[model samples]
Target: MLTRPISEGNLLTEHNVHQNYRPDVDGLRAIAILGVLGYHAFPGEVPGGFLGVDVFFVISGYLISTIIFRSLEQKKFSFAEFYAHRIRRIFPALILVLIVSLLIARNVMLPNEFAVFGRHAAAGAGFVENFVLWRESSYFDVATTLKPLMHLWSLAIEEQFYLVFPIISWLAWRTRLKWPLLVAAIGLISFLVYVFSSPISAFFSPLSRAWELMLGAACACLAPKILAPKSAGRSFYGSSFSILGLFLIGLSFFGSLTTSLFARPVLINVMATLGTALLILSGPAASLNRLLLSTRPFVFVGLISYPLYLWHWPIFSFWTIIEGKSIDLTSRVLAVSLSLALAWLTFQFVEYPIRTNKRAKFRLATGLAGFMALAVALGLTAGHWGRHYDANIQKIIDAWDFAGYPEPPGAFHDPKYNFVSWRANTENEILLIGDSHAEQYINAIVASLNSSADRPSPQLMFYSVMSRFGIPQDLLNKIANDQAITRVVVSYFWSIKYGSPKIDYEIRCCGTGLFQTVGTKGGSSPSENEMRSLDAELEQLLTALRRDGREVDVILDNPFGSDLAPRSLVRRNILSGIQINAGVALSRAEAIERTEPYRSRVREIATRVGARVIDPMDSLCNDTGCPAITSDGFPVLKDYDHLSLSTLIHHVGYLNFLR
Candidate 1:
């Protein structure tokens, strides 16, 4: 689709001769880059600077649309040629950035985290980073912050949009239909979907993002009509609109992400998008465009913007991983400097050589394919290794069976401790059910059960099945014997901490808990169905046990204090010279008071179910105030609420209440 350079004699009008490059376009690039940089560096600096991506999106749409429209109008529409231009323009620098960053991170990141990087790298090469990111959002894990290629989700959205836009453009040409209307409708519908599903689909999910790209496409189709020159006076309006566009963008950057009431409140994106379009159309005519973007340095940066975007994130992420630090102003500056250096090198050495040379296509294709295959293989290997490690750890947790204990470790070393297995004989056995807190104490209970102290633990077979929020009775029946098992222990942690209204609001607003209870009044209450289901499950278990003349013990929840002491004590002991006593520290009456509410809830549930309630709060507290130091000088609790293994082994002597 390449057009021969227009000779002076071939021009239809003198206006073509006077046409010149626009400097303001470069200034626009500077605006977009600065906004994006500020947003990433200090998020509060420009709340909506994230929209800078929308600015770039519009520019790409306008430029590419112009090129495609011009080529088609000139009777030059070759798919192979179109794709070649795209490959040369995008891949060379992207591949270089990925390779360099992967090498750097491979050496520094933990194996599990490094494996995730490799997988994302593969997804990026396939131009589906958006899909990968969409899947990751559900977990909302800490692992996400470490990914540098996370930003590539936007690139994926743009590429996918372009892939389909041209075919529609070509169809419009062949049929001579109202292509703009059809295209605009597509953009509108995509935007509606985006508005409906945002924050959920924020950084990923192309369906929600197609509108941004299409906004540019629509601008392109309408360009010939809107961009026609008028008079010198008209340039004033054009320049004013251009400046106005920048002002709107600046305003968005300063606005809050939460200000909009309507879904997605995409008005912000729309405004910035419209502004970018105006900026583009204003070029070739508006004096502001010519004066702002035509500078040598600005043009240079714009030329390498693709690579700059690709390199910045990974370098920043790897730096954070290496230093075990957060992203601060200093880190932002370093990241930007490193990104610029890498982008310049990539553009000059890799992109230029590959794009300008025709024969280099073969070499480029081979290298790309080989690199892709290698990355896939390595990623698969790493993933398999991680899965295997998880399996082995899970087995240990299951073997430990921590569900029966009053409190379980917040972080378990073994995954096996998670499961409940049947005794040698599955028939006529006890089954345990509840959420993680119930599961957490399984090991100690199992240990106590196996001890010669409690009726040979009844040769009891236990099933550790439980739900996080509530359990369904159907699953309970599936695991139960026809006749009641010897005894069943039902357990869960009952704490206001779990249902605190203020913590919920903070979590919804700031994406994290605020460390205080949201008093009981403000939050939504649990549904009747959830409560009924829990009640039904308990009643069924009790009925079945009674019919078989079996005893049932519903373990009362252990207390959960601030969950701060253990973490605090460990940090102090490891980092400082303070010889802290953990036991007395953990056993303080005040420390025990924090868990009293959970114990009360357990007692309430026990009364409702006519089951025995086991309260361990007194074991952890005395008549006196809670002591920060345990009598043994071991931190009283392993974590803020749960006793450590050593603490548990010591406390086992006091647990004769079970006997």
Candidate 2:
């Protein structure tokens, strides 16, 4: 299996078609896969488990570079053969996973969810999943949970790199330049970008992630020269460096290491990459490496790591969807056990057979083509289904959406105001100041104004809100200067804005700056101390507004129903052509129960500041339930959290606050 416990400094360990397969490398893959599996299935157990991907990059680079360099050096490298090998190695298991995923989603997921899945499936097939996800959100963003094909992004990145790297290697060989040096140079440039580029682009872009791969390639390219068994450098190459490497890997796995990037970044990745390279270079000669990593169990896992990675995430994601929340530990363990079984079976029955059968390569190619067709057809069918769902959603939207009039040239109608402030007589305009949370209720406010026959046409002045400020400096500045605005209504999505994944805001007082708040998302609510501080911040804003002689009304956040979009719920009900209350997505009682903390906090702060607290939860919802769809079968919300303009427009009399 392994180069049987090679003598110290005698295991330069070259691998080719004729060479013994390194079971130790497979063992290292085991470590990486475990890290990934642990992290995904139980992040609390393995927060740094993602570093396994870094380990994989290094292993992949070294293995690939070793093959390419050895072939090129011997003048036996072929592009056709290389790509054919790639197709064989990659597609069989992947196609199986895709087929199964599509089938499951078609039966279980709503039209919106399935539509998203279908789009990602096509992107995954094209090896553009990373780009598609990058365009959507950060890798670690909450949006990742819904996309069953999310992990395919890495495969896409690796495949995209494979397309370009061979040509680069070939050119270096042709030019008689040192391949290692060329790769190192390219890697250095990429590393710089990794460290300094915008976190999002750096994290997702192939151009930035290339360095991690290059590091492995560099290791392989220089293996013969630097990793050669040295007669004298026993401690340097044997146990000492290998131990340090393992330590680094452990540190990364435990997330004990200080380095981090956007909760997912480059420096932490470097630790795993470097550690994997060192351990790989140590070969099977190092006693510790041989004892632990070259074992059968570890090697078996390594063999199935690729397929396991593919199957695990989707299983967890779908389980979450089914459970209507995150999977519990028992479920996670069950999912992992099932994933391992599927992966092993897939590896044995699917991957090993097709990968080993050299003569049946043409058959492999034909099967791949057929699978591609199936994937395309699945994607097309999903999209076509989605279009019908969208058309229904659109008809509902048209009937309920309030903004029908076009804006006059040169005076923009801010959607928040629903009408241009300057175009309308603004001498007695109501000032609205808040983020998208406030913006969510624009239609409700407009509909109330439209029905008030006795009141002067209610002109509104809108100032965009930032979550970082309860009362923005811009709003304060506008109020200090403008006489047209007398009243200020504050609204925001308290749950989301105050929730984790927040940005740090720097408040400028002098030449220097201090961070006022950092919205690092950890959970739904803040700590008691943080809440007190937040309460104080609201009071400060209200007091300042009152001092400026402006009437301030703080509208309480609406009840958070099922966060799934209304169309999604509609699809769930209508997908089966059966309207069931059990499938309504959210009940008013549940919404009210959840809104307690928000309403209590808002009322507490409003009372302290002597400001009017507007609670819309009662107006929009009742004791029975908050229906997403209206009596006429038109949906109300754009999604679960935000109120649809049409819903507010049609149901305006609910606003007793306007009285």
Candidate 3:
């Protein structure tokens, strides 16, 4: 993620309020942008570079607050003029990026991918991209690298803050409120939310991010009182503070490599924010500020930093999408180089003229607004139109739809637990328990039973659990109270629960035109404590189920990897159109190797609890390999791991135990 700093030279020019430009601040911007660029282009080398966004937030807060405070004191602030300036400064580069992204996406993306991109573009235009991305960070969401506009989330947060903060400042100044005290109170509440909220919310929520900006605001409000009438020894103290600030920032950038983002976000954010504030407090004459920050190269990068941030991620993302996998170092370097060239061109031709043209400011603002509205319209239209595969290609695309499950006629929601259930004519019942891995088999069980006229169908009750915990009390009570329930089926995506390293497999097609698997390892494994907790929870669940005198059957997790994903089998080229590679498969030996730890752990527990162990690999794999597509050309997996509706209905008979 990256954020654009406020334009220091133009902040006060609207109101004829003079503030000296700090070249060191521009130097600081150079550091922040470079950090973000390093993280996106070479994550392994610069793991903590994402903290750059925090640095930008502080810079934005200090610069924008300074302008507002100074104009208020002079009684020259106007809401209309302030927003017009914002439009001029921020809109040109943003509008250019949005239009260009939409154009590129229309040609390169599949129908579903295009639809998703359209919605994201609309969110970006509306300044709600962060909320859209937050909601999409779920089990079934597309991979992050596939999205070109994902970097807009930080821009959305900054714009959202600007929308409300200026009004609050105006009201506080008008009423003669203690601005510093008010800022501190609001900032403290936001910081608490950042510290206590869920990981996803803490990362994307505006409330959780506001405190970083407030640190800069506090500096602006108190700088006059603290820095005025400097003593003879002030220069020495300034140099020391500046040096310490740089050290803290450098430490956070490198220290984050070993730390999980969710494990200690408070420490990382605080170091970056406080470090930025201290550097500003140290004044321009500080030794480091004069020698390092005021250098020409640093200031030049700082000047074009906004456009550069907007350009880099999309270039890298598109490259990944086109190549159908993680790119090589040469590709990354070329992308960065291309982004720099585009950013410099955009600043020279598009941004500079629009921002500096004082006489046409009103017209330029109005035109930019109109163009933004048009971008939103185009995005909405794209989403509404959905996928547009050719008739033959569409049949292949339709086979991957995960929602093709046939709903049973008697299906209804359980009033007590709010889960889906269906009653059969007979008194026999089968209770399905666990996470989504269990739910995926519901339709398959129904289909299997319906086709088998000789057997009696049982009532299906699914209990979906989000985490790896033992069956809850409410679920246990239902089993105890219902005598008709004779069978219990348990399943889960156990490799994920038992902390297996995620490996993404890509089916690539190039000049060779031969489909081959390329695997890339990602995500961290769970700690020893987490693994122990999961083991204990699993044992408790099985023991309780067996104690009820029911036939307990534990179905092992299915063989899955990115190679099995439907998207991996399909590729789009501008000249050739859709290319389907249905021969993609994973070797049975490798599948077993990947899932052996989970299978061994589950088997040991089930054996002790007297539960029957069922393995899906018995049907999904053969002596050679497990194919992503069936013999008839239907996709087996909807995503990286989840079984498709078509797969459950026709490919495997593992769930026949339910009958």
* TM-score for each of the candidates: 0.66, 0.78, 0.79
Off by over 4 Å in 3: 1-13, 135-143, 178-182, 185-189, 192-199, 222-234, 257-263, 385-387, 391-407, 412-438, 452-558, 572-578, 588-624, 653-659
lDDT of each structure?
Answer: 0.56, 0.67, 0.78
Comparing 1 and 2 on TM-score, the stronger one:
2
lDDT for each residue of candidate 3 in 126-229, tens digit (9 for 90 to 100): 88999998998763455567778988899999888777888998898889987797689879999999999998899899999999889988988877765665
- Over the stretch 1-659, how does candidate 1's per-residue lDDT look in tens digits? 11222211222221111123344554666667767776777676577777788888877676566556656666766665555556656777776666665666555543455677778887887788888877765322333445778788888887886687778777877776664775588788878888777675854777777777777767667756766655531467777866776666766676565465312347777777777877776654566556556565667776666777777777766665554335578878888888788877887777666665655554565565566566556554554543222332222222221113443323222222233352333333455656654454455555555564535343333344444433456645543444534566666654432443222232121111221112122455445565456556555555554444445566654444433233233111112212222333344554545545445544665666567666555565556644433455444344334454544655534444332
How displaced is residue 78 in candidate 2, in Å? Answer: 1.4
**lDDT at position 18, candidate 3:** 37
> Candidate 3: global Cα-lDDT?
0.78
Query: For model 2, how does the per-residue alpha-carbon lDDT over 7-80 read when each residue is reduced to its tens digit?
Result: 11122222222123677788888899999999988787688898888788888877777777888888877776
Candidate order, TM-score descending: 3, 2, 1
